[model samples]
Target: MRKIYFIALLLLCGNLYGQGLPGLGAGTTPNNKPILHGKNWVAITGKPLGATAGAAIFHQGGNAVDAACAMIAATSTMWDVLSWGGETQALIYNPHTKKVIAINALGYAPTGATVDFFKSQGMNNPPQYGPLAATTPGTPGGIMTMLAEYGTMSLEQILKPSMELAKGYPIEAQTANAIEAQKAKIKDWPYSKKIFLPHLGKEREAPEAGEIFVQEDLYQMLSKLVEAERNALKGSKSRKEAIYAAYDRFYKGDIAKEIVRGTREQGGLFTEADLANWKVKIEEPLHVNYKGIDVYKLQEWTQGPALLQSLNILENFDLKTMGYNSANYIHTLYQAMNLAFADRDFYYGDPAYVKSPMKGLLSKEYAKARAKLIGDMNDPKITAGDPYPYQGGTNPYLDILKKNQTKVASLSPGQINSTLDEQFISDFQSGTTSMETADAEGWVVSVTPSGGWIPAVVAGNTGVGLSQRMQSFVLDENLSPYNLPEPGKRPRVTLTPSLALKDGKPLLAFAVQGGDSQDQNLLQFFLNIVEFEMDVQEGTEAPNFNSYQMQSSFGDHEIRPGAIVLRKDTPEWISKELAKKGYSLEFWNKTSGPINAIWFDWKHSTFWGGSSDYGDDYGIAW
Candidate 1:
């Protein structure tokens, strides 16, 4: 099968130059489509089933926020990779209020969770089992928070579409692959396996293009929420009461007991108290100034600080003049990324537990100092800097510059040679997750929910697996001081949803799913639009690159590996130049991070939307 696929690719590659991939053009069937005007909306994701749910909400007179909520609920049913019982972070742009609010729906460690708890358990690090590893899920609270603050539609209206489809949506190849990959874990959870497996009591193969797939338990959960919402609207209870009732129905009622019982049977530590006491936090959004624009990000509980740091470094570069995907542009991006990552490794953590110098790190003076260290157009062998040293609330800058800068060059026209060859395996596996975006009336909503730790958590009533998450923390003795494990502290996360603005107007809504690659993908996508002025599709379809020279939750912590992977579409000359600049290139079939984006074309008065080909879906309507 591998040979057959490779041979087919080679045959296609024979005509790859000038002749693009079959579905690369506009209005491409299935992969790309144009929607009719109806408050101008489009939904794009990693699966068709998820997109259908978003589209249904738009069809139901629900605004983007309503549509986003529906889609998130639906994604849980379609892809176990993103479950409703997980953490979520969103960025909502309210045009009426002229504000972009960041929602931190990330889970927090249980009050009993701590490094010493693990130590007492004969575990050197946080255990993946029981109450110690389970953080209070914030997804439910997040959805409710958004609805109360910005939504005009009731929860019943928003949840109806997903409820109807939860029992089944047309399963596709991608959905099947996702299920099969995690079948071992799924089989352990009776409820999860019942919905995912076939009548033969085995995980089914990838479904054909239009086969129905059902998640009955999940459908029931949605139905209960809808009922609660209706009951709340009758004036018998307050809105908060209705929301909590629905939440309780899931966590403290039958479902909660099922989870607790299952975990206990499996030697896990979740308790009824943990579930009842779990509450999502409504914290302040981390704010920073990037090129005069007030950029709002999720708090450091996730990797939001790294994004701000990247923006700080980028503020000093003239990215517009560097041109799109040019060597100079890419090099500057890498340098900025390197600098941000350095701080991310050393100083980033839950601010409540660790005194992260996030404010000082994002200071303009610190950014300027870091900026001066890089030469104009030459690739440095190694980019190094301190993680924001403090002196009386300010850091001093030292003048450092290199000579012999190279001039930026235009991309040469020809067949671009891709860098993704077969020898690229370095155990650096990054997987696709789930995302949703909606705007009701003028209120915008975005959600990026991911299964960071997989294989340990099953998808259905047997409850979601969690062992993979435990492996995400760093255990280096030297870095042990920074390792995550604290009561009420959120682990460093990578599922990021972002909103971009121009001249104080919401311009772009976007996010990507790829573990540590999340922020890097975000930076590249942002630059593709804001700096290069590319259209939404161009930005989504650009040949992207990422550095493996840094440590991540998934890779070896080494610096001189020189491993870099570029998309198959990157220009050949660019690849050569990169190699000459001391990058060790590893080619791949495709290096993709599922990125979905919506661009507001103010001049045209239309919204252009796209989802990465790296995933299964991207949709739009206007």
Candidate 2:
């Protein structure tokens, strides 16, 4: 019956082939299109196995964190396209504490990486491929950290399904397509090619959709961690201590050594200290009060704040009055997004190195002032604002802000490599995997794990991989405060996950993986629920639009004025109207992103879940 409904929905919705593989489409899809509902819990993830693993945890009486971690492990092992060697960033809501927390699972540049190195190599930006593109492995550590700190289950317990998945899982078409698409690049690294394109007779070919894809090396790696924890348990260590033992085994023990050894040998710069010293920090999420509801985001290190800024600006208008998907709403959204993105490009960076001006950025007064700059018609030029005075407080990052100010490059063709550089940055930026879970216990988890991608050169024989995150770092020494490559400094990343609270209670948890397109897609999802009154699934599948009119978050940072790409099925009248208004309208034939979201109705004490029809998006309720 579910299969029948799924086929019907696909026929009704049309082909989402355009959502493309990992980063191209809306980030949600179903192997079976029937809406999944559960009175106890629900799981939505990038793969069927992920949803299954997460559901198993929930059935076993584990909390949301445990289920989410299990989902991460399963997806990381199976969905090589969305996340392989990727880092993780998550927004988790603890029902007990009633607090929303942000987890920064990303890694920084190795100590030896420097501006001089890229400069000497005649590269204007960090390399988008090979060892230099790789960053320290963070997925394993991040998942383990989440389980250890917030979960009720032990690592050994949560990872059983993942261990089985690692042994072998049938490759789906999307996963197969992703691997085959990168076959040339995979061949560049002997290790990656060996794992992704194992020999079936002499000629290398991508596994057929139903062929069993085995990761024996990855299986061994996971087994060792579980073994480490089991061994520790034999010594009568506490579960927490045993989890730590397993964590150390990856970051400080043999796993770390192998990662460092292979990376350095391949001319990458990771060190033993890089792995040992790295830890995922739990952070207070930055948030804004929007129509009495609080929308949470990660700090300046990610593009999360831009969504808040855009929302704040949009709050001034009655979106419903403008109508759903109306020309006015689209224009207003594009202009507001332009303002927010301009500020994001100028001000968003690692708080440790750059003062993000968060107070001013999220302040209502600042949004008002910035909103005043948006015109009814599209403006192609970049228009960043001054937030220091409007912030209502002294700028804490004054010195670094001044340094950043001096290095600003005027938007020019020379400063922006529109092709090679743009493609590279866009390709590596937010390419990611995502999962969302909600438990009857009131715990909600939204996790987007990215990094270790096809571009990465696998570190030796360790089935473990690294992320192409370092490629997100800019090479301009003059822009040191914002994007200069430095040891121990994490690149200003594009991975942003979101959680929302209404009346001081959890309302929604959602995330997507379109690099810069993430926040834009999410903004629409939020509006669809709050303003348009669409259910979570309808909102998630709604037609979406993204604009590149502002400076991009990565690479040469080009701002393409008036560039707007709408999904093909968007009303032709609306597209024509926007184009008439001097906006460059391009139709994207593929479906947009796979946005995964779970809406919590505290009043009804119920959970609603929705995902895309990309086949990769899987939702399960139990």
Give per-model TM-scores: 0.81, 0.89
Name the weakest run of 10 consecutive residues (lDDT summed) in model 2.
15-24
TM-score of 1: 0.81
Alpha carbon deviation, residue 59, candidate 1 (Å): 2.7
Instruction: lDDT for model 1, please.
Output: 0.61
lDDT per residue as tens, model 1, 1-622: 9999998775454222223332344333233333323246766666666777778777777777777766776665555365555666788887877887777766666555665666677775554323334565556666766666566567777676666666677766666766666667656655555666564343454344457876666666667666766777686876656666677765677666766666556545566776776665655667676765666677766666777778888888777666556666667777777777756654556666766666677787778887776664333333334444632343222211011011102222122222333323332335545554545355666567654233334423633433234434544433323546665566766666777677887677788777667788878877666655555666676667776544465433333234567776766876787677656676665565777877766766666676777666656564
Q: What is the lDDT of candidate 2?
A: 0.77
Indicate the residue-level lDDT of 17 in model 2.
17
Q: Which regions of candidate 2 fall more than 4 Å away from where they truly are? A: 1-32, 82-84, 200-204, 392-430, 477-480
- Runs in model 1 deviating more than 4 A are 1-39, 116-134, 189-191, 199-211, 238-240, 375-429, 432-440, 452-456, 459-468, 480-483, 554-561
lDDT (10s digit) by residue, model 2, range 1-622:
9999998665433323111122223324433355566788989987777889998999899989999999998888776443446788889898888999889888888877888888898888787678887777778878888888889888989989988887888878877877777788877777777788875354547777878888888888888899999999999998888998999998899978888888888788888998899888888989998888899998888888999999999988877767667677888898999889877876777787767678888889999988887776776654566687876667544565455445444445445322323364355234576789989888889988877765457787777767877777777533334666788888877788899999878888898877788888899889877876666886787777877765555556555667777777776677777877668776766435688888886657778888866436778987
